[model samples]
Target: MVWLFAIATGLIVANLYYAQTLIGPISRATGLDPGAAGLIVTLTQIGYCLGLLFIVPLGDLLENRRLIVTALLTTAVALLAASMTSSAHLFLFAALCIGLGSVAAQIVVPFAAHLSRPETRGKTVGKVMSGLLMGIMLARPVASLVADAFSWHAIFVLSAATTAALALLLRARLPQRQPAGGMHYFELLGSMWQLLKTTPVLRRRAAYQACMFGAFSLFWTCVSLELTGPYFHISQTGVAIFALVGVAGAIASPIAGHRADQGKSRSTTAIALTLGAAAFAMPLLIHSSRLVDLGVLVLTSVVLDMGVSANLVTGQRAIFALPAEIRSRLNGLYMALFFMGGALGSSLGGWMFAAHGWTGVLWTGLCFPLIALCVFATE
Candidate 1:
């Protein structure tokens, strides 16, 4: 069941990112203005945030298996629509729906938490999150490779088929979970604000992850531009290979989860934040050789990914420890908050790289974790 949940979450979440690295090709194919090309990814994220706030909370008010299956089907349809559309407007709308439906991955997460025993919940959530993180890290390279072999449209077509099949398999295999909550839909939504106000643990964990994820986003967003520029002149295939290297960082997820289970969350968080800060610092040191400098950036990717993965699992473990009835709402709020930070970080990273180059991006990314570390101290 753990493996199934992990695979399912990974596949579903990958839908949200298939467009990120394909933004140029997608925009060109769809006749979208290059100036507005960022919307290919931005609208999807906006839809995801909306769904995290509006749809994921329904996990506490609806039958869990049904909700997951329905969401997956929606994503499948959206992917199919995206594949067939040549109109930028239509494709953009499909991108939004893809993000909205991909929140099924989040629903699967809390469901995994609920099924696990209290003593092992952290480990369970950690394992599942490792898959989610892998999907995020792998989606870009997979998209690039697919587009290289085929057209960009083929990527969406293949994903649509896979998502539909996944939905069917999950529907057949997943156990039914009818949430015990009696709150109406609107009431369930309203209570998230209350949870935010009253739950200090949620607030702190969300804030910490927001910063960590912000740093993660900053580095990743700018790194591609840096590699493709005059410094490295790395081809798309080379960039894809660099992305694959970062998957090693997902190993930290289960380790951090096991530590959190041992009641070491505080220390684990501190270590994670420090590692995030150090990732940026490593790239700041000047190296004369281009090869040596590229090697340093590769190391930075691994270290930064490890820090983000560890902190994410730690935060999820902390929040999932809350009451069962409120776990879904808490998860939704937690993800929504941190996702906003990611949005800001990516936006900031692009501007920084353009305005002040890699040095500026590194310094800005460094501040994200340093800020998180400061907040960790207060806890």
Candidate 2:
């Protein structure tokens, strides 16, 4: 069941990222302005935040299996809509729906935690999260490769087909688990504010992950653009290779979870914060040779990915241990906060890259993790 949940997460979440590597090509095809292309990713995240806020809370009000399967089906329809759209207006709207539908992945993560035993909950969440992070890390490279082979539209076509199949499998296999809460839908949404106001741990953890994710979004959003620029002059295939190399960071997910189970989340989070800051700093130090700079970028990619992935699993493990009945809402609130940061990072990344190039991006990315570290210090 754990492995199944993890694979499901990887597949479903991949929908959110298929657009990242394809941004350049998609922008060119649609005649979108280079300065505005980052919105392809940013708008999707904005839509995701919308889902997290409005739709995800319904997890506490509806049956888990039905809610999740329904979300997946919506994703399939949205992906198809995206693939068929020629105008930027239509594609961007479809992208938003894709992000909204992808929140099913969040619903599933908390469901996985609810099904596991208390002692192994961290480990369980870790393994499932490994799938989620892997989905995120792998999505770019896979999208790049697929888009290069066919057209950018082919990426979503493939995703839509695979997602439809997954929905069917989940419907047949996933066990039913409904939240015991009899709270009305509006009341369930209302309670998230109370949860946020009262839960200090939730606030701190969300802030840390929000900062880490902001850095994550900024780097990934801009890196594909950077690689396509004059220095590297890489094609989509070449950028895919860079994304594949970052998969090394996914290994940190389970390790972080194991440590969290041992009650080491605090120290683990500190290490993650430091590593994230150092990742941005490394690129600044490698200006002498292009070869050296690329190597440094690769190293930074792994280090930063490891930091973000570890901190995310650690945060989820802590939050899931809170209360089973409200687990879905808690998960929604936590993810919504960080993803809002991600939307900000993506918007800034595009604008900064357009205005000041990689120098601007590096310094700005550093600030997110540094801010996270400062916030953590107060805790």
Candidate 3:
């Protein structure tokens, strides 16, 4: 049943990544400026951030299944609209809706927490995140291939169709649980500040995730720049191809979770994070080798995903152990910071790349995990 939640997360979250590869083709197809292409992703992130902040708290008050289903329906419609759009503004709007609706994954994750016993919570979260990593890892190269073989619009159209099918499957399989009494919007918003200042665990873990995700974003953002430059002279397609190396990391996510189940979640998290930090050294050590690039990309993907998934599992395990009424609020607070960190990371990575090349970006990225390590050690 929890694995059912995993499938649900994977399919729905894939919608968010659909644009990763299709962004270029979509821009070319619509004759939009390359600079505006970032809007596609930015709008999506904004919408997801909005949903995490505003809509997700409803999971604590509303029926989780109903919220999940309704959100999925909205997501499908948004994707359909994206497929039909030739106008840039319309596409941007559609992305916002798509992003807002995609927070169904938030509902699904906490719902997994609701389903599991305390002892197994880390492992359960790990299982669910494994699915997320798989969706994210495959979404890049796969979406590119789909857009290349077909048309860019085909990406959104197929997403809508697949989403509709998934919605149907979920209707029967997903359990709708009515949580305790409702939380008002103001209270939900208010609690975020309170959680940050008051809950030591929440504060510490959220900070850790923020920094780590910053580094994660840094890795992905600049890897393409490095690959597509003179040393590799690789095409954008080859950059996408290199992302496939991350599939190994996706495969290793469950191991992180399994270890978490044995009461080793924190230790597992630290080790994974340390390995993730080392992955940043790959390019610094070996300046110009395709084999090194591929090897390091795969290894880095493994450690980074493993670290992130583990930390998230650990965090969820701890949070879910709290009173059930506050779980949604907890998630909303944590994810807001997480997403905001990703936004900061991407922006900073762009700056570093522009000013100092891929190596500069790498240097900037290496700082995040080291900072995270220190934070973890002290906390």
Candidate 4:
């Protein structure tokens, strides 16, 4: 059952990343400028934040299986719509739908947290999160490969099919869980605010994830430019290779979870943030060497991914332990802030790349880790 949940969660979650590796092709095929290609990512992120805020809290008020399957269907249909579109306006509309459906992964994570025992909740959530993390990491390489072999639209066609399959699997195999009604819909949002305003730890951790993710977005958003330009001059195939380096950390996540289970999250989080800060320094140092860039990229991905996943689970575990009645609302609040940070990062990365090039983007990258450090230091 747990493994079933993980696979379903991973597959559904991967939709969030289809645009990550496909940005270049989407730009070329759509004839949109760099900043415009960036909007494809930015709009989806904004949509995701909306879902997290408005839809996710319904997890507390609705039926779990219905919500999951309904969102899955919406995602599948949205992918189909995305594939059929050539007009930029229509494509952006599809991206919004994709974002709404993609955040179902967020709902699934918190659901898994609720299903597990307190002693094992961290491990369970971490395991499911590893799938989510892998989905995020692999989207780059996988999308690159698919885009190279076929048209950019083909990526959405495949995703649509995958979403359909996962929906079937989830319906056939996963047990049903119902949502608990602790507060009304408006009350839920109100409670989230009340919690955020009142809980110092949740605010601190959410803020940490937010800031670091912004920096993370800044680096990835402009990396395509770096790869396409003089130094590497790589095609889509070449850029995807960079994403494969991230799998190392995805592989390391289970161990990080084990350590979290041992009550070592606070220290682990600090160390991870410190490593992430150092990792951002890579582009500054290995500005032109392919081999050196590859090495740094892989190592930094390992550290940064581990840190993000660990801190995320730690924050959730802490929140979940507080009170059972408000778990869904808490999850929604945390993730809404988290993905909003990602949008800011992606947008800022695009602007920085335009204004200052890689050097400027690196300066943007520096902000995420520094803020992460402050989060750890103060907390």
Ranking by lDDT: 2, 1, 4, 3
Candidate that beats the other on TM-score, 2 or 4, i.e. the better one: 2
Supply the TM-score for candidate 2: 0.99
Q: What TM-score would every model get versus the actual structure?
A: 0.96, 0.99, 0.91, 0.95
Which residue pairs come into collision in candidate 3?
none
Residues 109-222, model 2: lDDT tens digits: 988998899999999999999999999999999999988899999989999999999999999999998778788888998999999999998999999999999999999999
| Inter-residue clash pairs, candidate 2 | none
Top of the candidates by lDDT: 2
Q: Which runs in model 4 stand beyond 4 Å of their true positions? A: 286-290
The reply for model 1, stretches above 4 Å from the true place, is 31-36
RMSD of 4: 1.7
Q: Which lDDT values do the candidates have, in the order given? A: 0.90, 0.93, 0.76, 0.77
* Clash-forming residue pairs, model 1: none
- Give a tens-digit lDDT track for model 1, residues 126-241: 99999999998898788878887888898899999999999999999999999998889999999999999999999999999999988887777668767878979987678778
Residue pairs of candidate 4 with colliding backbone atoms? none
Flag the better candidate by lDDT, 3 or 4.
4
- What's every prediction's RMSD, in angstroms? 1.6, 0.7, 2.3, 1.7
Stretches off by above 4 angstroms in model 3 are 30-39, 235-237
Two-way lDDT contest, 1 vs 4, winner? 1
For residues 1-379, write the lDDT of model 3, one tens digit per residue.
Answer: 8778888888888887777656556777666676455456656767888999888888887888888888999999999999998888888899889989999988898888888877777778878877877777777777776776787788789989888888788888887799875566687778767867887877777787787777776667556656656767766567567677776676556676677677776787687668668878765676456777666666666667666666666666666667788888788778777777766676677567667887788888888888889988985
Candidate 3 lDDT trough over 10 residues, lowest sum:
34-43
